[model samples]
Target chain A: MFHTTFYIRRLHSICGLAVLGMVLFEHIFTNSMAIFGPAALNGALEMMELIPKPIFLGLELGGIAIPLLFHAIYGVYIALQANNNASNYGYCRNRNFTLQRWTAWYLVIFLIWHVGYLRLYTKGITGTPISYELLQNYFQNPVVVVLYVLGMFAAIFHFCNGITTFCMTWGITKGPRSQNVVSVLSMGLCAILCLITLTFMGSYLI
Target chain B: MAEKKVRFVIERQDSPESQPYTQEFDVDYRPGLNVVAALMEIQKNPVTVDGKKVAPVVWECNCLEKVCGACMMVINGRARQACCALVDEIEQPIHLAPARTFPVIRDLLIDRTRMFEALKKIQGWVELDGSWDVKDAPIQNPYTAQTAYEISHCMTCGCCLEACPNVGPQSDFIGPAPTVQAYLFNLHPLGKFDKPKRLNALMEKGGITSCGNSQNCVEVCPKFIKLTTYLAQLNRDVNIQALKNIFNN
Candidate 1:
């Protein structure tokens, strides 16, 4: 019989790679909003806005619905499978697998609450334009700012760590030299992403 | 710098046909010295504890770095290259033995011919057909170049095979390293030309499906190569190749 860990790792890789590509696409598109001015972004949001009465019920049942449910269920499965409880900080061991498990769990919970608050209810209450101004205002709140910072940090760390493991999983970094290079590069990339998020939030919000 | 005395209990055998025994020795160590260095000190003076003279212990070392993979032995029960194992970092009374996974040649030396044979069976190399000029070989996509650069770092260290449960005496499973190497070649622009041949090799009994996904191979690989990722991708590639073959037939 196949070990459950293999299935989980493989699934996690699939999810991580696809999600990473999606996030990257969104980031580029969102940043491009600057070119057309804040009104353009808000206008686009206004154009695509969903109705709140019956559609709200549909979204609640379907929007953050099926995909989120399936993702979370499988996310938990992967998190549980990747965990190595026996290690308990043993000497002479590689900590990659254990670290991957811990990071996955942390990100899944954080993402759920983030999406719940940001998109689900706030969109209805604020009824505000999804412009740069609105983004600045949302981030200006201390709690929002701190939460965004922490969430972005968690996401970036989890991302780089996953990418490192992904390299290993795909046999890309085949040995010590390649691993050392990828380790250094992954950390550098994560730092760059963190800097971009923090600088933007810092300059615009504060 | 002062010389520190290091103690070691090494498993020794005179030849492939001989019986084995534990031999202890105390050797003067220098800063940044390794298990192999201490063994060399013992070689200079083949004396054992309790005042007994003996034959010099035989092992292997080349490059004095971790690249050659010739210096792999069990240090404190962990399979690693002795050249990179610093004496200061290791716990005292460091026990040394030839890696039990391979046939013991003598004291601290093992025959790693099994790994070489596995590599051979997979034809783990770019076919050197002389048809194309060097300039005309298809330029690699930058992404492909980046991925290939990572996969090319394998040093043929047998740690992955040693840790793999399926790659044992009773089984013909090719283990993780060789399989991953095959995929590396398969990804090349020109290397893709031989995709069918390599996929056929993978479809054989010891091919990609034989991997049990115990993941022990990835855990113990000292080089930190991602064994499972290539294995999974290879599994997908082989399945696709089989479908294509069916249509062609």
Candidate 2:
């Protein structure tokens, strides 16, 4: 019954905001604890580790993995189909239009490397819970640090810009004035998140 | 000083299948002359600035006003009504081209069948069972009626489509004009009976979901229709329709 593109598009948006967005928020916030030094960061990870393995696995699989997969895959299809003429029609919204798609493409690669290297490969190989020590060691690599910096910015922009469009898509912001307000608010949120993330990364470099 | 002249670089196509090329012309300038008038002058002489005699540029217009959307073309890189595009207001070497969103029939003329087809798909009319006159008709809220009146100004021009990145050779989007029309018709008391039908059509591919909401449509719309607002309203309506379909089925 939900076979139409209309439903599918809405479902994609729902997955992005309801599922992926929440997870990203939690991830950034938790990781930001690293700015307080290893003890605070380890404390946060230890708290997450308190959840039972089965429940954690279920949450990861259903809440994060499946939805992220759908969002990325469907997102790629949408990106490929887009005919971006932002070069010709270089209006502010049009530039954002092109940037949204480009950022999606970047996130696909960044996510694969970020999640794969950390979540799957590291966890699989080390056979240890992710802790401050692990991230500290991981961020020791200058290349990884650069990658993470760029990746974080891309993710933040995608999510924050996404909030504006999501509002429009679901009929939240109806007019140009309301849309401008929402865009400003969303960008402010993006900036704050970026600052927190940068502080988190700074803790590693030192 | 020499006689005032308006320079024009008009794009011409021999046939629908032929390649389009630009031809420059000099139209003797007149005060308050519009782009359509400039084209008319060029048609009379049918000669290029380089002194080559050629077939008159083919274009379409009626009413010579902005009300009829027939005279719409790209004037100086913007899709607008040539009738209202005054010569003095626009930059010289006035660039004229067919609104490329629709297939170019020839020269500055384009085939707007796709827009009409989209209108037909949306059932963009108040359907009445019979011509029998009725004494009592439901009154509409003045506010709602005003909004509907604003949306009703759309003349099926392809300017919105021309400016839209989504509606092109690469995409299947029905574009903003028809979607706004769907909202316009659905606002009517008599049109409410077919709301389900219209919403279902919008639920399909190349429908409301196809809109990327870059908002170029609203920016280019000559009628100043609140296209994005109506689109958002329809987005809400169609989602409600989908939910109804789910439980009712």
Candidate 3:
């Protein structure tokens, strides 16, 4: 049997890559629809609206929310217990390790509030049809806009750096050269993600 | 000419149970003085900056050139051997302390028995089973020999463990050096025969997965062992071992 700490860690990595990662990928692609136009974004939303309510609720709870909640809570546990001696040691990955923990925190806070506010307004509470108007109104508030930008930054950073870590930890990147490839790829991924996410965000303001 | 003076702010504890406090010493700085030499100078004097005669600072050392690995301690906020830490290279009022990761014995020493335990748990040695030296010892490939030579440089100084974040009294991360040791033994032909056993040990609690790959170990290792690289290899090997277990069993 795998060691308990090791097992939990592997599970954490697995849940991170397989479940949460897919959700982020899907959400990003879907949100990138805004780059086309508001109508395009709304049309994309309509297709999603066709999924039966119970099934949709189930997907949100089972597929995204629950797994995400577990990943976040467990991440918090690990981050809290983990220490970083990077200041003394001055290693590059040690800095990344420390930054990963910080980004984990930022992502958790932003996700909770973002998900709650958006989900409740659109589905759980208001049942309002999401449109450019809704986003515009949302972004009108300076605080909301700031939170969204910060949240987007945290999520992208957490995801991108996480990809690099995932590769090494799982042995997918066995050596330095291969890991370097993964690192560069993840950085590119981060760049694309930030551009699209922020581009759409700016469109909402415009 | 005025005596070139060096000041030290070192953490000390009288006994394992006693509280730790800071002690200061001012010494006549000779050119090319290292922390170990400075400690020796202090040991001879046993006097404080405040002019109080105190007990000599206790520390461990041998092969003062940094090879023996006995002289490791945190010098100036970083963990390294006091032996090679030349005085002129670093700042004055250098802060010295026992490695915080391990429990202190007295002044600058801590018990590194857990490291030995980790090595034992991982079965670091190649399995001979009383066949100390086989006449037909397997000839090695040049590449494998090169990798093995790199791993053989580890001196068990406990720097990797001390600088690591996850390692402490509460956590069971066996540190990085032993993981490289596992890979080293796994590469030997006879050692390769028992590879599954060693990999299985790695699968045990406090094994390879505990490493988050912050890589402070590689940075701080005086031997300059590519610890994370071996860890990366060991990670791959462990997975293959798991797969083998699944199919063979």
Candidate 4:
């Protein structure tokens, strides 16, 4: 049988990398209001609206939706398979494996509910069909803003952890050379993601 | 100050089919006493805590450091070297038993031959035809040297096997220690010459595919060796081997 770790970890990496790139683009375009002007941001938003709703939703569901579900499900299978539980290596030991799996699940559930309420339902956050104006109207709620902020950070942490683990899983990182690199990158990714997230959330808190 | 008494509850087994029982003893405490040292004290004077004469406790030790992994046993429910487990650090009435992952040979001794057998199955070595001259070997990078050095630190202590859920009496899984060793040698630039053979061995029954990825082996390894990481790599390596076999056929 094909080893699931190879396929599942690679799947997570491909999906996560694509979503991260897309989210980064969206963030830059939406927040261009302060950089250029309200008119510039509106122009960018109008261009985004030209894309068909079904196509956009399909991309969101396929890219952000399906891969995550498979990643989390297979991630759990791998965790349960490896657990002997005879000895305790402190809570931190092997916890990242399980934590990453559960966090992926949390992200999926959070994303589905938030997306449906924010953009899909008629009486949802936008309170109208998903037009550029509706999208703008939805971001006005502080709760939605906070949830999205946290969700984004959660995604960042989840992706970073997945990427680092993926390297090890694929044997890209091995022995002491790659071992040291994995350690540095694992911590580095977490720190950078945390910083970027704090920067984004800090604006709202202030 | 007068010496204080310490209690020990050690489990004894005559053979694989024999029943096990606990025997308690009291030893005179010293400033730098360890479990092995205390066992030595018991060996010198074989007597129970209840003032009855008995056979001396039997155990194994060497190197007195953790390097050899020969003195490995269950101390207070933790698998580690008895030579380094300080008496003071352990809770009172320190319990000692042979590691359950392997067949017990006696009181605190286990047959680690199974690990060696598994190593043999994986052919955990680099095969050389002796055709290449000794001095004509290719130079390796410093990075490769460093990682090989870490992987070389493995003492085959069977800690990873004990932690692995797939390795048991009922299961035929070869466990993680041997597989990691297989990867270690196979990744050697010279060793890569035998990569196909190694990969084939890993792809066989009780090979790399048997690993469930619970990552318990990584957690319990005292050397902090990356067992799961290597196992995953072996997965990919075996996949390539499978394709090559199909294409060749």
What part of the reference interface contacts, as a 0 to 1 fraction, does candidate 4 reproduce? 0.23
Task: Tell me the tens digit of each residue's lDDT in model 1 across A83-132.
Answer: 24224223222354455456567667777776666666676566544567
Tens-place lDDT per residue, model 2, A120-189, is 8887676777989988888888998988888888888888888988988988888889989998999899
lDDT of 3 by residue, A135-187 (tens): 78888998988888777777787788888888888888877788779888887
Query: What digit string (tens of lDDT, one per residue) describes model 1 on residues B97-212?
Result: 88766788988888888777777776777776677655566777787787677778777777766655456555567778888888888888777778777777876765665554
lDDT (C-alpha) at residue B90 in model 1: 90
Candidate 3 DockQ, CA atoms: 0.64
The best-first sequence of candidates by TM-score reads: 3, 2, 4, 1
* DockQ of every candidate: 0.03, 0.59, 0.64, 0.13
Docking class of 2: medium
Deviation of model 2 at A162, angstroms: 1.8
Residue-wise C-alpha lDDT for candidate 4, range B132-185, written one tens digit per residue:
656555666577677677778888888778766667665667889898788788
The recovered share of true contacts, given per candidate in order, is: 0.01, 0.58, 0.71, 0.23
Lowest lDDT block of 10, candidate 3 chain A = A1-10
Model 2 CA deviation exceeding 4 Å by range: A1-3, A125-143, B130-140
Stretches off by above 4 angstroms in model 4 are A1-46, A82-102, A108-112, A115-150, A175-178, A198-206, B6-26, B40-70, B74-78, B86-121, B125-155, B162-175, B184-194, B200-249
> Which pairs of residues collide in candidate 3?
none
By lDDT, is 1 or 2 better? Answer: 2
**DockQ result, candidate 1:** 0.03
- Per-residue error for B165 in candidate 2, Å, reads 1.8
Displacement of residue B240 (Cα, Å) in model 1 is 2.1
